[model samples]
Target: MTETPSTMQMVSFAAWRDGALHSGRQADRRYVTLAELLVRLGSFGLGLSWKARLFDRQPHPAFAQMVKASAGSGIPTLELLATDAPYRQAVDGDFEGYAGSELALTLREFDSSCWEVRTADAWVLSEIQRHYPDARPMTSDEWDTTT
Candidate 1:
């Protein structure tokens, strides 16, 4: 089932990253649903497995992108994240990512709730977005404008 970006609506990136803590401008792009993203990247099997593991819990597509970004930024492993995710709770406080990795990269979801976490660094995104379709980072305008 290949879904288009026009079909679904996503939560705002600001909603997830808010308050004085929020830094760096977020890009404006539409996100694909979890199913669409899985099919987009041929990661359906993994998505399904994760869905099953989570008992089909928040089946939104954004999660896949979250996992991808977190790992790429070397923030922390999902296994560690599982210890404290924003589900069924007030989200055990903020997650200040480890610095010194020099990773200006972060994750951002689209209005469709589909997302990718790539560097806020424009030069890097232009080079990498093509290779990793789902995880491509882009400038705000580039993200907003449909190619």
Candidate 2:
């Protein structure tokens, strides 16, 4: 297995349709690696059966693939969204899960060249920056902003 990259940009878009947690309608960024990213991602499945499957002290299989896929790209990353905040916080100080297990599973199950591939096989950060070049690094104070 490849050593997880030390750090990668984490881009979090908000989930407006998801309700309350989605109220903080700002995308954000932070640096993280496979370990933390898994916890952060797994948190999304919190209270669900998949929660255990989402996080592992070691990277989960799905997450490992994501790490490997991103590692070969220009910017190693595990892109997620703001709807993930509560899950991340619920993990008891473990910044493990991010809110994209569905995306991860889709990528893992489908052909990379398939039209359905959501990420279009591009570096996630590239995709984010391509669409929202104005996104800046997030500050703790701005974390709760609903804009």
Candidate 3:
């Protein structure tokens, strides 16, 4: 299996779907291999179940914010690492699950030609096909957003 791309090596995998280029850091990056990615993705289901337990999910802004707050508190959220891991456990420990898991995979495969396309055959083809059926695929030049 290949080594997980370092955080600095990541670039957004730009593709068209739903009507726009769905570009952003793919939610999962630290996992080193396809199996690892899938293994972590498996937990994605379990993680989704936790939201029901949170009713006062207010002071925390968005879902990401609630995730950060939970991770910061004592529980675990998205299993994000710390560049250092002194502050994570259980949930892999990310500050927050970013975009979608498929997006994360796409971002890591940004160098692949298949991923740089308007076609539905992306690194995250299923997600692209599902969420961005009408998005206009893009190039790095076209996807230069500050966010």
Candidate 4:
């Protein structure tokens, strides 16, 4: 059975960057749980299996992008399956561990761009609010009317 997603509200923040409409700044995006905020925690750790660790330590840019996509898709957690990955089955040895290999595979095969954008926006807003308590989310009108 598929697990139902928990009730999670996502806030967003937007700012001018590099004089561009879509700056695509990395640090400008972030996300966290409301409960986590209450306790002053930003992220949760997901222990990976040995196989998954192989890709995780030095993940390619695409790999990181895929992770963002998954997170955006409401994947609360990424799990490493017990089965061996077909990609590296030939070099298989005593590689027994629950790594996030399944997640990697899924991301590589699927596309979740829309979800990624949505989640990333929320993440950025959350981070900004967390770091700058006084800095409020602004509207186009507010920005224009300010100065």
Candidate 5:
């Protein structure tokens, strides 16, 4: 088995729907962070009968509030994240999961059109890149400016 890194660094990328890079809103694209993706994988098993197959943790307090409000108001989670101030604040706060001694992996939505997956695990990053041939790495400057 491959050894996991002691400290993981975030990798940012964009997956274009067209399988090619485009400029200036010309094509449908999803901005993804490696950590968010991992959390999503964990979340998929939340209501299942089997034990969660991926890392799982209680959501941040603010995030839990947004979830409660979204359920009561019948607003979609994505819509809540996009339009609700409290949801945005919760997202801005620490909301990622960490494994062992690795750094926290944050899950955030930059455009609010989608929730990007983020990961600090190199193995996960490599697997995602292999599976997603259309995904391209985002430079630190690009990631910083957008986030």
Candidate 6:
């Protein structure tokens, strides 16, 4: 079943780059739920037998627009927050696929020099903090405004 807006968990995050909190000017537009993000970005198919495979999925049209608009400093680290249960995509058929929560999503720079992490799991967030001590949590007001 599709989750209602109220039941769906909203994720928001603050990004850090060059040892400082990067101005997340584009965050409001870039950040979205893992499901929506995946849909927007699309994926290549793996030869796996699972039903969950994307199978050379094509990205939404807005993805190109987003890329065109994304001209700014890159943030290497991003810590996401979500208070509700994690989002899951259910699949059908005999294989059943692997049933696991999508705990995190990462977007890497084109040069592979940097990456951004998005997660709802506290443990993952803590791990991010351990590595990037300068990373800061987003204020409720910021989350309220951005999401």
Tell how far residue 53 is off in model 6, in angstroms: 20
Q: Is candidate 2 or candidate 5 better by TM-score?
A: 5
Cα lDDT tens digits, model 3, 1-147, are 112333212223332112333477444323132122323344442242111112232422333443444442232323322212222112111222222222132222222121222222234344533443443445445433321
Off by over 4 Å in 6: 1-16, 19-62, 65-119
lDDT of 6 by residue, 1-147 (tens): 122333222222333234334586443323223333223322210111111112113434333223233223211111111211012221110111111222133322111122233334355455555654654554435434421
Q: Which predicted model would earn the best TM-score? A: 5
Question: What is candidate 5's lDDT per residue for 45-120, written digit by digit as tens?
Answer: 1221110111114545545554455332233323433433332322222233333333234444444333333455
lDDT to native, each model: 0.32, 0.28, 0.29, 0.27, 0.39, 0.28
Q: Candidate 3 at residue 3, lDDT?
A: 26
Question: Sort by lDDT, best first: what order?
Answer: 5, 1, 3, 2, 6, 4
Badly placed stretches (over 4 Å) of model 4 are 1-6, 15-43, 46-61, 64-128, 132-147
On lDDT, the leading prediction is: 5
- Model 3 ranges off by over 4 Å: 1-60, 67-123
lDDT of model number 3:
0.29
Candidate 6: which pairs clash?
none
lDDT of 2 at 74: 16
**Model 5 per-residue lDDT at 92:** 28
Candidate 1: tens digits of C-alpha lDDT, residues 21-139: 33585654432323332233332112222211121335334443444445443333333334323232221111222334432332333332334433333443443344343443245
- lDDT for model 6, please: 0.28
After TM-score superposition, the amount by which residue 135's alpha carbon in candidate 5 deviates from its true location, in angstroms, is 2.1
Q: What is the TM-score of each candidate against the true structure?
A: 0.26, 0.21, 0.26, 0.21, 0.37, 0.27
Q: How many backbone clashes does candidate 6 have?
A: 0
